[model samples]
Target: MASASTANRWLRPEVYPLFAAVGVAVGICGFQLVRNICINPEVRVSKEGRSAGVLENYAEGEKYAEHGLRKFLRTRAPEIMPSINRFFADPK
Candidate 1:
């Protein structure tokens, strides 16, 4: 009778790839199941509301940054607009 180690050694190496393939398929299925359960669309509205509230809390900061960017672009428009117009006018 073969020893345990010898029996294991006798197993074909080709079986390893089959086992790995099965493991990957099972892992993918488990990940998809977990993602579906955690992010079901029924709770999307609540998630969006929470994210919106967070954004609202920083509204003043965003508004100031937006105004600064707009002012900076307005001041630089003469320098930037010509290049942009030239680039778009003819791709070739």
Candidate 2:
């Protein structure tokens, strides 16, 4: 159909930069999300050691969500940011 063919236009060279920009934005958002979580629990981590820290943050976030998933996700999630940073910044 005409609509399907038009979708293929995104593959053209002119749109490559648009794709790249979106990729970068998504990557940064992902990285920030992980960083915000893993740095909780008052644990200090080095720069390189943080590669897997996001997983820890996710687990901690689960506990924080026990109150109410949808509500807590929007309101209290930021509470962990400072604690996580403190932990992640500590010298091991």
Candidate 2 per-residue lDDT, tens place, 1-92, comes to 98888988767899999999999999999986786666444343666655545454666656554545567577654665777887888778
Residue 2, candidate 1: C-alpha displacement in angstroms: 9.8
Which regions of candidate 1 are displaced past 4 Å?
1-11, 42-92
For each candidate, the alpha-carbon lDDT, in order, equals: 0.65, 0.69
Task: Show the colliding residue pairs in model 1.
Answer: none
Assess every candidate by TM-score. Answer: 0.35, 0.40
Q: Model 2 misses residue 4 by how many Å?
A: 3.4
Residue 64's lDDT within candidate 1 is: 40
lDDT of 1 at 59: 57
Each prediction's Cα RMSD? 14.6, 17.3
Candidate 2 local distance difference test against the native: 0.69
User: Which stretch of 10 consecutive residues in model 2 shows the poorest summed lDDT?
Assistant: 35-44
Q: What TM value does model 1 have?
A: 0.35
